[model samples]
Target: MSDKVVKRPFVNNNCIGCGACIQVAPNYFDYNKEYLSEAKKCETYNEQDVNNAISVCPVDAISWI
Candidate 1:
């Protein structure tokens, strides 16, 4: 198997419902029922794409796992 680790975005409970990340990278994130930001599941994205979203998160809730 390839050693390339599939990096997925994760939004922690510290999210403040800010859409900054979504605006920066909609493909990697979305809003939950509680209006909080959550990472889209079951998908792999480029590091740059995920990093853009993470950089825009004011609450620093987004990360890679």
Candidate 2:
């Protein structure tokens, strides 16, 4: 198997204040003053959890870089 690395999660401009990411991975995401979901200050290197959060985003605003 090739060793691939999952990048950290990031919120994009498409965010619609949905809480799906937060619900799926609270440790990696939080809401900002604009009610938009954003990545938490601490890096959540857990690829699975981050991917789960990305998958649940209704707006598909979450991505990795």
Candidate 3:
């Protein structure tokens, strides 16, 4: 048996466009037309940065899966 580490980040409808996640990890997060935070598409990963963003979100919108 082995433990799996999930690194992909997800944003829910609760996003308030606070830009906290964008400030913490710009490479992973961006603002849509609605100004909500959304994940960017890329292969290079940064779990620590993403986690930092998740921690700072005021509405608890960002999460890892």
Candidate 4:
């Protein structure tokens, strides 16, 4: 296997106050007072959490690269 890790895209505007990201990666994401998920900036990828977030997103706004 190649030494590669896909990165997940964070769209601040596209986010629709969804808590899915937070549910999947509680360490990486959290909900604001308005119930919107606050995406954190990290150097490395959380593979399992990212995948789970992608699967959980209702609007398909989270993109993986």
lDDT per residue for candidate 2 within 1-65, as digits (tens), equals 24555467889999998798899899989999999998986633578889899888888898888
TM-score of each: 0.85, 0.83, 0.85, 0.64
What is the model-wide C-alpha lDDT for candidate 4? Answer: 0.70
Q: Candidate 1 regions off by >4 Å?
A: 1-5
- lDDT by residue for model 1 over 4-52, one digit each (tens)? 5587788999999979998988887889999998888754577887888
Model 4 pairs in collision: none
Best by lDDT: 3
- Tell me which residue pairs clash in candidate 1: none
Candidate 2 clashes between residue pairs 3 or more apart in a chain or in different chains: none
Model 4 ranges with Cα > 4 A deviation: 1-6, 32-35
Clash count for candidate 4 is 0
For model 1, what is the error of residue 34's alpha carbon versus the real structure, in angstroms, after optimal superposition?
A: 0.3
lDDT of 3 at 33: 89
Number of clashes found in candidate 3? 0
| RMSD of each candidate relative to the true structure | 1.7, 3.4, 3.3, 3.3
The per-model lDDT (C-alpha) reads: 0.83, 0.84, 0.87, 0.70
Q: Higher lDDT: candidate 1 or 3? A: 3
Cα misplacement distance, residue 44 of candidate 2 (Å)? 3.9
